[model samples]
Target: MPLYKTLDPNSQTHVKIWKITETYEDLLQPLSLKPESLERVSGMKSELHQRGFLSVRHLLRAFGYTDLDLYYDEMGKPHLKDGMHISITHSFTFAAVAISDVEVGIDIEKQRDKIAVIAHKFIDYEFDYLNKYADDYIRNLTVIWCVKESLYKLFATPGMLFREHFFVIPFTLEDEETISWIDYKGQKCRFNASFLEFEGFTCAFTLPS
Candidate 1:
């Protein structure tokens, strides 16, 4: 089994992580999917994206959810039949999902140096805190990118320009974990975020505070 790190904090949020691996297909065999759902996903060009959904669905099934129990809203945000908050994401090889009684969001990304070239597009206020040294730039960019992506998924609102609004507090890249706040439309939402380095990929997730 892939390692699952679960944090059931006493402080109003619960989180868990399942690292994606080559065995993702095997793990998905137990999930029963409807023909309609397959037809819907079949149009996606990336086989990786399709498998990511399969892995996510398997995890939800293990948590006692059936295929038809999950639905997406008009904005393409997911909703649970039982009314639980849900968020999902998949990178090149990993897929992640977060569920909470309170609203939640999660994101995973493969660490890549290319993010630095486009940092100015998705990052603004976070730049001041990032290490400008070439060796540290990519890792720093990855963390900030992951943080913003998580916030985007959490808010599930269109027209969210990352550079214009998202801001990550200053912290050492070596810390591996941090707590941050997001200012969205006058609401200051607290987030607890952490980074994991595995198999040359980096992933991060946040839950409401």
Candidate 2:
């Protein structure tokens, strides 16, 4: 498949998503990768992850970038050699990239009942509004997790924990938007977060609010 979706959340931020529907070999055939990137993908134990990794490279091409143009820092945060802020995420069958003049982060997750089992680990303040008995409990949990995951990626701080430092304001699925906070070490920051669900998967991203 080609680029699955493109979004301009703000004038300065651009996002591209790819639906992974090709064989690992099919994905690798077109793109030229940096040696380190080839090494990274070659070390993957699962072909699915290998395909996901390659699909993100295709996404960089959609953004007019090549693998040589992307690199990561000691914190494992991704950067574009041109100085554009960049973030990458891939889960299951979807891979996405978000680039901006300002820092930004994006995440995609497959919705599943098991997310509810680990909800406590990443959820604390959100528990105040969550109702386990609700029919959409799992869906809401997935959205919150996606939002927080994006925040964690954007912040890129060493010791931030989702359960302890991140907070999401109350929101409904229909709105698909929320204000999230990072209260780490007394340095509070906020972001405008948005999310959408498709084919039983949820995708979310955040930019400075």
Candidate 3:
């Protein structure tokens, strides 16, 4: 198995990343999926997406769980039958998961120049510190996007707008970590955000501070 990276941010949390190098058939060989999961994978039109789905199952197996032990909530957030909090993410050639005793969220995104084009869509207050001409602009933007996305998954609240509600504290690419908040509907919660880049992709994950 191509388990690319494993991290224990805390004693109670586990993060696993998989470099997706296996064919869909090879990825499917070692696992059994729930009927719903099987159906969901079957309906995915892209073979890459199917492989990402299967790779997630492999991650679950690394955590000593199986597809049968997982389910999605009304908000489409993933949960474990044993009650541990879980979050999932996959992009291009990678897939990852974060599970913790406390609520957590994870996101992996391919670093792309296109993120700069749509930066306004998810960024508002953050614009104050972002320099579009900086050498690390794309990396910084990817981290911000991933931070907001992970916060969204953690909140799992409907109608949350990334630009309006999610805010990531400013940090340089060298910092590799920052703080973020969700300010929505008179409620505010803080989280610790951390990120790393590998093979042209950026991965960020958050846990309640």
Best by lDDT: 3
Per-residue lDDT of model 3, residues 1-209, tens digit only: 99999999999999999999999999998999988999999999999999999999999999999999999989899999999999999998899999999999999999999999999999999999999999899999999999999999998998999999999998988888999999999999999999999999999999998
Which structure is stronger by TM-score: 1 or 3? 3
| Model 3 deviation from the true structure expressed as Cα RMSD, one decimal place | 0.6
Q: Stretches of candidate 2 above 4 Å error?
A: none
Best by TM-score: 3
- Model 3 TM-score (2 dp): 0.99
Candidate 3 CA-lDDT value:
0.95
| Inter-residue clash pairs, candidate 2 | none
When sorted by lDDT, best at the front, the candidate numbers are: 3, 2, 1
The clash count for each model shown is 0, 0, 0
Off by over 4 Å in 1: 1-29
Q: Between 1 and 2, whose TM-score is larger?
A: 2
Better of 2 and 3 by TM-score: 3
lDDT string, candidate 2, 1-209, tens digits: 57888989888899998999999999999999989999999999999999999999999988899999999889999999999999899999999999999989899999999999999999999999999999999999999999999999998889999999989999999999999999988799999999989889999999998
RMSD of each: 2.5, 0.8, 0.6
